[model samples]
Target chain A: MIEGRYFYPHATRFVAARASAASGMLRVEALDGSLLNEAPAKSLRLSPALGRLPARLSLGDGSHFESDDRAGIESLRRELKLRAPGGLLHRIERSWRGITLAVLATAALSYGFVAFGVPFIARKLAEATPPSIAVAMSRQTMQILDGRALAPSALKPKDRARLEALFRKVSAHEPRGAGGYTLLMRRGPGVGANAFALPDGSVVVTDALYALAKNDEEIEGVLAHEMSHVNHAHGLQRVYQASMIPAAIALLTGDVSQVSQMATVLPGILVQSAYSRNFEQQADDDAAAILRAMGAKPSRLGDLLLRLEEVHCHKGGCAPSWLGSHPETAARVERLRQETGK
Target chain B: MSGEHEAAVESGAARSYPFQFEGTGGEYFGIWIVNLALTVVTLGIYSAWATVRTRRYFRGNMVLAGHAFDYHASPVRILIGRAIAFVLLLGYNISLNFSPYALLVWIPAFLIAVPWLIVSSLRFNARNTSYRNVRFNFTGTLGGAAKAYIFWPLIAMLSGGFLMPLARRVRDYYHINNHSFGGRPFETEFTGWQIYSRFLIAFAMWIALMVAFFTFIAVSAKFMPHGKAVSPNDIAIMAPLILMIAFLEIGFIVVGIATMAMIYNLALGHTVLDGRHRLRCRLNPLVLAWVVITNTLLTLATLGLFYPWAQVRYTRYFLGRMALEATSDLDEFTSEAFGTQSAVGEEIAGFFDLGIGL
Candidate 1:
């Protein structure tokens, strides 16, 4: 026997002698032969045993009657059927395509802005600044600093020797054209424990940072990482672009009006900015290569990263202000671990 | 009985619409609200389970031409796919900065990862089955599923602003053409202008209401009596001030309801279809008004006890009144278990666990 349940229409007769259009306490039933009395009638249900069947029920005067006119009922029943489960899969499939298209569209749109919009804006900004005044201002500032009676003339003999040794160690296995490397150790007002690399190939490691290092290797790791930035020419590129281009524009365009404004914001534009993650990775790779070439363990970098992480804990994963343009200590540590397979 | 007699009985049954729809103990709404709440609370983890529950309910209860519906989704596949996507996104971001040129490679890699997900979902869903007296069939392709990704961003972007109407049109178009069953095809079309105009009017109304509300607030504050010292005149004026404030509150409630109605009407459009069966989507103004008023009072009075009931009532009214026209010989089945109270606990639990809407 082909066993199947059929939902039969429930017959409702209003006991009220008056024919009222209002429907209250309607009765309904399930295909499984379960009766639901005085239930609100929102949807009709029918379960069939064999082929398709269609019939409509009439509602009027507090009475419900099934009509032979199954045309409307069948269509309505079909409409009410639950959407197939495959529809979800179908939606997912469509979503995948939609995501791909969206990604491409976003890329295209961003590329358009970067390639066209940025250049246009740059040109406009350049047109607003003159080059000569910017050059003179920078030159004058350098002269003023140079003429300062408080500025130390040159490093002490022992400090010079140490700086020379550090430079040699950092540049020993540096990749060609990665970046030019320089080391500057000078005595001035104590700036706390800090180390920084300027865009002009100048790496300043304060005496306080040297005091904090557990050993020379940790210091070497720091120098190697900074050397990688130099070898990559990132520092020079940033400095040249930041200083000269704007200055040149200012001088050429004869617009020193925004020069003061630019000067005020320049430190923010230059300092403690983040390099791209990819750049960080590349620098990590470069540093790793340098350490390998110098016959030193790459784990030294990872160790330094951990120490830095502890130091920068309160800064929400950011490096200290001196190392602002660098990756967070946690990221640096992770990258080193990944590279060294430790 | 002979096969022919069996066929006749099935055919007859398939054609009957006798107000015989079953109630799944309000599990539908329970699950919906639960999932919605869970999604809100859990920050969307409950969505996966919610999706499964939704599929189970719809599959278990649906009857068409005497046939039931079946659905399936693999949690493992979904989880794994999500993990892989997350990892890839992380890697892609890293690659983007170090070598901006590397984005070229990442783009294609991202594209390739998508089809695996689409195919897995399709295979799992199609294999799930339901049958009445007749055999049920499920058919779909990877290409169809993959197309979804193409439109989703457009939908997202369009939904954000004046482009909502265009977005709705695209959504309607995609939804209509994306299904097929029993050798029959389903399709729908919506004009962009219709959606756009509706949204514009709704936005305008919202803006006007906001303006009026602020104006009333400003005017009331300005007119409120202020004096150097507390006196009989100042005390006497407080009664009218309180009344005016009460009146303003009522006005805000009315305006809020009107805004919700306008938004609902604009976003969903007024028509929906399951295959060739077309249903005119009508927003019952009266029902909407009751819901708005009742919801406002409930929220104000009980601090929110009546929220669930309000939700159930509105959902019921909307789902119940939607009428579908029959265009084919197959029996149509409708289910309305919107206001029943089954699985509410599960839903609430899921909502809390998922931290859904936050």
Candidate 2:
């Protein structure tokens, strides 16, 4: 038997309701003992139980009974053989053992997703993005950078043309044979000694970087690295990866308010950094392969990288931007030496 | 037994009823952890369902005048709304990828849409919440929302923030005045100037903190030796003092507690439901700040596993102090079926990091 308060939809009052196996029905009685409702046991629906809150059982006529009598609810269910499919969720929610197992499972799954799943998915998505979208993204970035931090090339006309020819030679030897690749020579005093690839296959070689290289082969090495970044769509992948941060944060906090502020700030930070250590290594490996195809020693790029690091690392502390965002130069040079059989 | 209680309430016998929240930290903690586990297990696909279940638990646990409040949103509806919001977000990202100039158009367009979005969100939420099975309703106009959300904030900004109190008043009035339960409107009688009077305490606290900070700096400069070179003894003596000053500076921000508490107290104190029911909020700023700071520390220490406890403790502290003075019998209010509302604008506003007006 079960007893609880019943609320009819049309009235703002409570009626007494009772159900019994002997009667094989549920009935509601008004305050003055008049019959308010009577329905067969099969005509009622039960809301899923959540915590210690009252359980609500609704009849066909829109009136519902709310009760916290756990024993009575269980008995009623057993009498009717009500096979609640949500028994699994209810069991897991009610027991300490199930909750402990869930917590551990969730922890392991989240760690795996963050450590391995997200990067792999980002890489695949980047690879699948249309080349035209990548190119447009790169062009827009270059225009914005030019307006802010870049100027016309400060090197002599002959020097600029010579490097341009070297860029053309490298592009020709590519598997796609100069597939929409453009090389721009520009002075970037603020971003000293840097080479970067835009998503659209445009590589910018700063005057400071060109001057920093000891020989044409060294400059060729840097060009090869930049080309690899463009070909692999690293920039686009980085942006896409940043877009997932809020989702990850939401999972961690389980609160909507906590992840809201990250939507605006996370994208800016991701775009400024080149990418992860794995991305940097891939670019380096590609640069070495390109140098080998050209019959030039791949060690030249490593030598240039070491020199650049030494120049930037004045007084034993490297620039914050250099050491923080990018991988260690010493490690990359060591890897390059191994590839070159040095 | 139920009939006798109903009669006592109808005889114009007044009572000072304290709102009740029966949710315990341990009970809610289980629900919270389970919700989180399932949300992660489903790769966020089940978050909409999780949201509904969480809302239902909290609302169902709250009892007023012998009846519990209820939330009637469907998980499928919320999922569809969230999907729409995510698609819009992707479109915004694509625009950013296309060109920086898209920002020129996007910012203004986003601002213009804020009022309409606020209205939609309020309508969606109010239409879904029910007490005694009668759905609450909101009828504020988009134009009124625009004036409250945009124009007043702009005027406040233009006036060097002196008119911020007025902006808050405008927003509060818009929220309270438009709310109704079964066709009876909520009435708020407080004015902008009244809010400003309460705001003066916060403003004064800010000025005093600034003066004290500068004074401390001046005193330190007078006593300390010049130049960057300092002895180890000097460093040891100054470090603790500097740390203490930093702590004091953070403590000064507790004025935020004062400001927020005063706003809620004043606003709710003047708001009348059905022109008969009265609300009283008696929150103490120091106590509130203590709860906030300790809860934050505890949640951080446990790496957010303790969040459910912290949330429950905070809610119970705040709601426990609130009371409703019943002038008429609450049992007389009958339930009327209302049309369903889509959760799209609520989810979209949530995506944009805007608070849902309560």
Candidate 3:
């Protein structure tokens, strides 16, 4: 028997009581063994076990019985052949060995999800995004760039036309062919000697990169890389990838305000993590294939990368970065050149 | 203890009962990690149950007078609420990226929904809590909530923030005054100028901190030798100034906490139940800040495994300072609450991170 207090239906006042389920019925009695009420064991409900607190059992008439006997409740449920609610979870919570294993499993699962699951999910999301949404998003990006980082093209008309011919040749070699992509030339003093693509198949080629390229093949190599970015929708993919980690963190932490500190670390992690390297590698591989399809050497793209690296690293310091970093450049260059052997 | 019970019965008045927290860090750590692991394995589908179990653990461990409090929210209801909230949140995040018109639609919709969310969430949480079988209740209306949460803040900003503390006072008043237990209202009364004074002091500390910073910079520049490397003598002069500035920065944060504690104390201190029994709070700002900062740092260092310990420590220390001055043996009450409130409002409010905690 468990000694506790019994409350009448919806009443606050309670009396000293002894509770038992030994007779296949939940029985409560005054201390002298006088019956207060009795019900079938299957008809009663037990609250979940929480720490070392008293367990509450409801008698379905709004009357409840409370006792600090977890083991009694466990045995009572067992004898009645009744399933205890939250039984497994509470056992896991109460065991040290179970907790340790849980911590290990949590760590492994989180790392696996963030490292592989997020990228795969990001790819699916990018592919599923509607073209109109992509167009609108790209328009906003171009507007922001124009307001801050981009200006009118300063290339001579002759240089621009020759570059247009190279672009057309690369576009023809792409799976979507000529109409699938478009190119724009602009002077970006801030972004100096750089090229990038938006989600809507618009590739921006800064004029300084034109001045930097030694030959048409080198420029075509750069176009091929940017076109690959367009074909795979990598820009949109990065946006989705960046948001996934914070979303997952919020979900696991109950999306509460107390975890705002974790949110602040997202921008730094998203901008500088290995996910960017994977995107760059994907685009590079595709660009190498496009180069080989155009009957040109893939190493021409590597040559431009090294040339761009010289301009950047010489100005400041030679620290490898997200793109064309000193050490990563050697690996990327060797990979692209190996495409030639195939 | 028997003699003391007889004495309490004889007087039937003016006795104080200190709130006690009996939970230990070691036990809570086990429960918290297990909860988190299950939540993750289910991809957050089990988080509603986790939240319920965690809250129940803390509530059942809190002792008031002689009886422990209890939380009785159903996890299945909370799960349904969260699923709906998740869909809405996902929609909001996606539309925010895909459509520029989203803000124009979302802002007004959210603003209109704020009062309902606050009222529903407060009522739901209050009705789930019980002491001695008598559940607490909230009877505040949406109009009252809007006046407190939206109207007061906007008016405060229009007054150029000189009246922001008054806005806080109104909000605390709205929260405390509308709550009832056993159908008797709880009331809190405090003047706006009292909170304003607290804000003024914190602001003064901030200004003093900036002045000290500028003074340190000037002193450092004055002691530096012209057009030459700084010597050890110069270093000694700069080091004391650096130390002073570091102290001032810490003081700035402590002063902010002091302001928070003042408001906290003022709100709880003036609160009364049944027009006789009074609630009192005496949180030390220095201790509060120490616990808060150390908890944050430790939680970060341990990658969140220290969370349960941090929570236990805070509850044990802070609740020890809370007390109820009773008028009787604390037994003459009846449960008056059984309203079935949907949990969606609270789930949505959590999605917005409204921080409506009391």
- Give TM-scores for every candidate, taking all chains together and pairing residue i with residue i: 0.34, 0.81, 0.82
Docking class of 2: acceptable
Question: What is the C-alpha lDDT profile of model 3 across A1-342, one tens digit per residue?
Answer: 888889887666678898887678898999999999888877798887778888788888878888887787677667766667777777887787899988998888777877878878888999999989889888887887898999999888999899899999999988778998888889998788999999889999999999999988789888988888898888877777656665566566663533335333643374335777777788888888888887888888899888887786555445345432123787888988898678
Over the stretch A3-77, how does candidate 1's per-residue lDDT look in tens digits?
122222221111211111114323333334354222233433232211112222223222232322334434333
TM-score of candidate 3 chain B vs. the reference: 0.81
Predicted complex 1: CAPRI docking category = incorrect
Q: Comparing candidate 1 with candidate 3, which one achieves the higher DockQ? A: 3
In model 3, residue pairs whose N, Cα or C atoms come closer than 3 Å (at least 3 residues apart or on different chains), thus clashing, are none
What C-alpha lDDT does candidate 2 achieve relative to the native structure? Answer: 0.73
Residue lDDT tens for model 1, B1-358: 5586446545643233211123243333344444444443443344555555555454544443333454434444433444444445445643343334667897677566554454444334433332221112223344544445545555657567555555545544444454333323345555567556666655666576668666866887676657644333344555555566676665555554554555444433433334434443456544676665665465346423343354445445554444434444433322211111121110211110111110
lDDT (C-alpha) at residue B291 in model 2: 79
Interface RMSD list for the candidates: 24.0, 5.3, 5.4
Measured by TM-score, the strongest candidate is 3
- Model 3 CA lDDT for position A76: 69
Better of 1 and 3 by lDDT: 3
Relative to the true structure, candidate 1 reaches a TM of 0.34
Over B173-217, each residue of candidate 3 has an lDDT whose tens digit, in order, gives 899999877566799997767777878877887788788778878
Task: Give a tens-digit lDDT track for model 2, residues B138-195.
Answer: 7889899989999999999999999999999999999989987666678787876779
